[model samples]
Target: MSVRGRRASFISAGVRFIVILGLSVASCWPFRQSQDIEFTFLLPPGRVECFYQPVAKNGSMEVEYQVIAGAGMDVDFTIVSPHGYLLTSDFRKSDGIHTVEPTEEGDYRICFDNSFSRVSEKMVFFEVILDGQGAEGGGDDEWADMVEPESMLEYKLEDIRESVESVHRRLERSRQMQTLLRAFEARDRNLLEDNLWRVSFWSCVSLLVMLGVALTQVYTLRSLFHDKRRVHT
Candidate 1:
């Protein structure tokens, strides 16, 4: 084969290989679809439930989540970081799209409050879509290998959910205690007021009795003195 022809053949092979690799990578790239993940929690009135969404840690981006409330109930949401920072907060907003951005790769907490709902929240969904360049990586083997035992995102999120749950339980107990205390306080106040009113009523009655006795003594003395004065005159 001529030297130039041989070189041309080698270049053609290289181009084919490059094209094949490009196609393979593009086909195997991670899916960044929003519906890939779904998280739901049911909280009774005046309670909060939280969950985590896995995200790419290396990039600077936001986790955009779509929240749909079960008919009749609205949701109030707050995004907390692994470190317990309020990254984002919203309230009284109807079901719609929301976004949360993290500074680093870690657990991001989305707290769903059910207190806003008078009825049960039958369904709440969280769908995570990568913002940019989203790569889930190559082969099934490569994908499996990239997954850590527990991602920082998962770990931090779990911790936050636990914290919120603990706080939720505490809040429930506190509310109950406060209600009982208020009942007791109200009863005591009413009883004391009633007693006070009764005491004043009796005190006034005693004062009138004392005044009546003094008047009787004065009249008796005046009658005796007048009789003596009349006899002397």
Candidate 2:
């Protein structure tokens, strides 16, 4: 090949490689239509708090909740479907996880009830994960239009895309696990602190009682001894 033709061919090859790599990365990028909500709320005594989440048909929903702080460390939880059906209900539960698959395309209700505990309020931590709803990625047609039908680049791109997707899924799971662990840790810490406070308060009260009794005993003994010495004299 002539110098100019050689240069032209090299430039074309470089452009093709770049295009393939770009398409691969774009297609493999995680375009999740999923919604993740994490919330911590206080449920007052004699009250019920409810939240709504809209989900599409054939989608999946997962709800996890924990009563992190309260008198009893428990609350009543309920899930209602779009059609006013009760899907799950738990009374006086400390923690729970619920899943709904192939959900109806409407609003779902989640409620926490603290009416039974008329004196103690509750602190709740909850998470909702909605998956497989409006995912929008994978530009396969764009890749096909830019590459030859049987090119080696196409196969390499497919491999790269799969690898990227696999890594993305693993990372997502890892993140979810970490979040759950943090919630648990917070609950445990709160419990420990509460217990410690109670113990310290009672210890102080007992110490004060002991000191009062000891002083009274010492005074009574001195008075009795003084009376006896006077009678002897």
Task: Specify the highest-lDDT model's number.
Answer: 2
Report how far off residue 21 is in candidate 2 (Å).
1.5
Clashes of each: 1, 0
- Single out the weakest 10-residue window by summed lDDT for candidate 1: 149-158
Residue-by-residue lDDT tens digits, candidate 2, 28-54: 554556678999999999999999999
Candidate 2 Cα outliers beyond 4 Å, as residue runs = 1-30, 137-155, 228-233
Cα RMSD for predicted model 1: 22.6
Candidate 2 residue 39 C-alpha distance from true site, Å:
1.1
* Residue pairs with backbone overlap in model 2: none
Name the regions of candidate 1 deviating beyond 4 angstroms. 1-36, 40-44, 54-71, 130-233
Considering summed lDDT, which 10 consecutive residues are worst modelled in model 2?
146-155
Number of the predicted model whose TM-score against the real structure is largest: 2
| Model 1 lDDT, full chain set | 0.55
